[model samples]
Target: MTTPRIVVIGAGLGGTIAAYEINGAVGNRAEILMISDSDTYSFVPSNPWVAVRWREPEAIQVHLPPIFAKKRIGFTSAGAKRIHPAEKRVDLNNGESVNYDYLVIATGPDLAFDEIEGFGPNGGHTVSVCHTSHASEAADAFEEFCKNPGPIVVGAAQGASCYGPAYEFALILDTELKRRKIRDKVPMTFVTAEPYIGHLGLDGVGDTKTLLESELRNRHIKWITNARVTSFEAGMAHVEEVADDGSVKSKHDLPFGYSMLLPAFRGVPAVRDIEGLTNPRGFILVDKHQRNPKFPEIFALGVCVAIPPTGPTPVPVGVPKTGFMIESMVTAIAENFVEILDGKEPTHEATWNAVCLADFGDGGVAFVAQPQIPPRNLNWSASGKWVHLAKIGFEKYFLRKVRKGESEPFYEKLALHVMGIRKLKM
Candidate 1:
């Protein structure tokens, strides 16, 4: 009998850990391979720090080739050009193809900066910290801006799924400026598409609105919510403030010497626009088990997965796939594959909980939502200096796990179990 092959696409946070966990689960029963665009794995959560020079790019990056070889898994950086789900084959950019009995698609979203004119780092006036490379360039820009500080703008764009990093980057800039004693010369403004301060695409988990608002107030950061950025000029941003009825309430021309606005995200080119596989936004459609209904052999997790908005808002807001939530999906898929190999139907499901530690340079906010949506069983949030330390610890610990090729180590499982947090549904 031929050994079944399992191929995982993308090597970001979710895909890399999924490969490790799946390999451990299936053992020699199946062959495992990973396809990534680059051999280096970057910790994206650290990108905000990279922008302020708090973290060097190399500190958060890991070379995957050596580690995958050590784990006895096939690794390639050729990247997929397109996914032929009907034929169970993936076409690579290098004119090669690979067939798989089971495939896991975890390619993270593509930043949609072009949707807004002159709004990104490429040829645009604003800067970006979405990628490590972009963050490095932003650091250089930051250094130059500090020499002659004027005004700063930071926030998330309309339809943006991720918001924590925007909040983090904004506050981190404040902290850095204060440290440099140039904050008084710089006016900071936060502009967002959310109706209120901490909607965060999950509808204000546990007093997040009050908490985030207080933070901005204490820092003297003025904000405009329900904002739609129409365009960005050399030193000005055109914005329209939308009302609850979806009509334009006002408009403003805000001037800034430096800006970093998080862009909206869509699925990568490889698996986009497939009729049954993706939604209109190019996000993969998955059932409760994280398996695509149209192609049972295809599964997906992370930012690329399609999740409906929590509710209707004046501006479109997308739900964020937090790290722990993505891990829950990864664990569920690994367990499901094990059941399939044992001649049983796949039954495992992820808990999809959201546990986030949003670090601000000095202090931070932490929140936990049991199911990551509104009306959840557990909704808790807090803020303290300890949260910032916890975030740093998490970054180091996660990097250590990747280096050791370990997933869900014994201590981590024990810690989560003690806290009554689980990755898989009961």
Candidate 2:
């Protein structure tokens, strides 16, 4: 019998963890290969720290080749130029192709800053923390702005699904300014597309609205919700506030000396626009089992997968696929793939719960939205200084786990078990 070749795309957080867990599950029964655009793994959750120069890029990045090789997994830094799912092959940017018996797409989202006029870090009006390079550029811009503090705008743009980073950066920025003794001089405004202050794309988990609102209030950060940012130029942001009935409530010309806006995200071009595989916005469509319905051999996890808006609001608010949810998907895929290799039907399904930890510099907020939708099994939110410390510990533990090429270590399981968080409820 031929050794079944399994190819996993994108070595980001989900992909790296999936590769490690899959290797552990399947052992040497199948050959594993990982393809990524870069040979490094970055802890994306720490990008806000990078933006504020609290953490350097190298501190959060791990080289992938050596790590994968140590685990006896194949590695390719060349990105996929095109994915021919019908032919079960991925054409590489370097004129090579990889054939796989099973494929996992964890390629993550492609930031859609181009959707807005004069947005993003490049020759644009605002900065971003979506990528390491972008975060590094944002650090420089942040330092310059600190030297001459003025009005600052920090939030997520229209069509942006991930609200955590926007909230995080705003609070972190506030903390940094207070530390610099310029909090009195620099006025900050948060502008988001969510219908309410703490909607978070899942319609406000627990008392999130109250918890986050109080935090913003205590920090003296004013906000605008249900806001559609039409464009930006130099120091101005054009915003349109919409009512619940889908009518324009008001329009405003907001001024800012420094801005950082998280843009909308879509699937990467390689597998995007594929028939029966991706949605119109280029996000991969997968079944409850994490497998593409049209292509049973294909599975996707992380931001690349398409999830609908929680409900109908005046403006669309896409649901966020939090890091914990993605890890659950990875575990599900690994377990089911092992079943497939055993000549049995795959039965594992990811629980898809969302556990988010959003840290400010000194304090933070966290929420658990079981199943990541309304009417959840568990809906809770809380805030404390320990959340900030927990986030720091999580970053360190995740980085160490990646470097060691282990998916779920004993201590990790023990901690989560104690916290009552399960990767998947068996």
Candidate 3:
């Protein structure tokens, strides 16, 4: 019998964990190879901390080559230039092609900062925590800004899916300014595309609206919801606030000395424009089993997968795929592949829930959304200093798991079990 070859693209969290799980499930029966653009894996959740200089970049990054070698998994830091699903081949940028019996694409998102004028870390009027390197740069900028505090603008741009980081950064910035005793000198304003505060692309999870609104108010962070940022100049941001009927209600020219806006995300070019495999925005479309409908041999995980917005707002808002939810997708893909190896059709489905932990500098908030939509089995959110500590614990635990090449840790299982939470119903 021919040995099955499995190729996983992008060594982000989803891709790495998928490779680990596949190795454990198939053992020596299959060949597992991982391809990524970079040899280092950075814990993205720690980026906000990095931005504030609370954590260093190196503390959150793990070199991939050594870890993959320890697990005896094939590794290539060179990225994929193109994927020919029809030919079952992935062309590497370094001039090589790898063919596979099955492929898992967890390439993550491509920041669409170019969508807005003067809006990204790269030669833009704003700083970003979207990448570790970006966070490092932001930290330097933040230090300089503290010397002469001015009006600050922080929020997510229109069509941005991940709003948690924006909210967290806003609160974290508030906390940081307070610590420096310069908050009184800095006027902060939040601008977002959500129809209201705390919508979070899932349409407000468990009193999230009231909770987040109160939190923002207590921190003195004024907000403008249903607002679209048209562009940004050196010291000014142009915003247009819209009503529910989709008409412009007001416009404002806000001034700022420092700003950080989460840009929109789209599918990376490698998978973008692929017929039937991706949506208009380049995110991979998958079935309930996490397998592409056009090609069962191909599957997608993480932010690269397409998830529709819960409801339409004045400005477009994409739904975010949280960390735990990505793990569920990874698990489902692994289980389905195991079934295939057993000569059975894939039957497993990811629970597709949302479990997010957003930390401020001092305290944090956490929410759980079973099925990731409204009218769910479990919908809850709470905030406290414990959540902040828990977030730190999660980062350390996640990095350790990557080092050990562990797909799922025992403690994580225990916690989720105690919480009556699971990856899938089965």
- Please report, as a residue range, the 10-residue window in candidate 2 with the lowest summed lDDT: 409-418
For residues 1-426, could you state the per-residue lDDT of candidate 3 as single tens digits? Answer: 999999999898788899999888888888999999999999998999999999999999999899899898999988999999999999999999999999999999999989889988889999999999999999999999998899999999999999999999999999999999999999999999999999999998888898899899999989999989999999899999999999999998999999999989999999999999999999999999999999889999999999888877899998998887888888888889889999999999987777777899788888888868776887888788877877887788788888878877323453354334566342
Provide the lDDT at 280 for model 3: 97
List model 2 lDDT by residue over 1-426, tens digit each.
899999999999899999999999999999999999999899999999999999999999999999899999999999988999999999999999999999999999988988889998887899999998899999999999989989999898888999999999999999998899999988888999999999999999989899999999998999999999999999999999999888899998989999998898899999889999999999999998999999999999999999988888887788898887888899999999999999998999987877788899899988777778777877878888977887888888888889999888422353354345665342
- Name the runs in model 1 displaced over 4 angstroms: 409-426
- Per-residue error for 163 in candidate 3, Å, reads 0.6
TM-score of each candidate?
A: 0.97, 0.97, 0.96
What overall lDDT, based on C-alpha atoms, would model 2 receive against the true structure?
Answer: 0.90
Per-residue lDDT of model 1, residues 278-302, tens digit only: 9999999999999999999999999
Supply candidate 2's per-residue lDDT for 237.
Answer: 93
How many backbone collisions does model 2 have?
0
Clashes of each: 0, 0, 0
lDDT of each: 0.92, 0.90, 0.89
Residue 257 in model 3: lDDT = 94
Query: Which consecutive 10 residues in model 3 have the weakest lDDT in total?
Result: 409-418
